[model samples]
Target: MPYFAVLYDYAPGSDPLREHHRAAHRAYLNETDHGTVAVVATGPWSDGEPGALLVVSAPGPGELHAMLDRDPFRLHGAVAQRRIRSWTPVTGPWA
Candidate 1:
């Protein structure tokens, strides 16, 4: 499995909606206990900018996209722009 840093580029002023879906979003991340998750974290971008980091793991690009599609926040339009790329962590805990 490979890890990916799924970044959601959201428009400004969407924090409330993002917080509202936090619980469901957390649930989804936790559900990936069978080696499907490498690492995961969520929070606003730099300087209170609107967006989130959804770093996790999948078998490949297809698997990653499928996982993103299942995210609750994705369904509710909390995510504006979704970026998917193969992640290589050189340091830190998940690295």
Candidate 2:
């Protein structure tokens, strides 16, 4: 499996939608299969931007995208942009 760093940019003024779907979103992440696509770490950015960063392990980008597509936030258009990049950890807990 390969690791990926995913960045999600929330849509402008979509806080209501995100709040409404937050439970389902968390549940989805919690219920994901470890062998398939494990969510290593995830959290919202504390900066001025309204977005989140997620480190996940999966077979590839296609599989990761498929899994993410099922998230409530993505389904309800709370996520305006998504950036996926391959990650190789050298000297961290993930390594």
Q: For residues 4-77, could you state the per-residue lDDT of candidate 2 as single tens digits?
A: 99999999999999999999898888885744899988889987789999999999988899999988999999
Residues 1-95, candidate 1: write the lDDT tens digits: 67887788874566787689879987876784534545466555777667767777778877677777877888877788899877888799777
CA error at residue 50 for candidate 2, angstroms: 0.3
Q: For model 1, state the Cα shift of residue 2 in Å.
A: 1.6
Local lDDT at 27 for model 2? 85
Off by over 4 Å in 2: none
In order, the Cα lDDT scores of the candidates are 0.74, 0.91
Kindly report which residue stretches of model 1 are placed more than 4 angstroms away from their true locations once superposed: 11-13, 33-39, 92-95
Displacement of residue 7 (Cα, Å) in model 1 is 0.8
TM-score of each: 0.75, 0.94
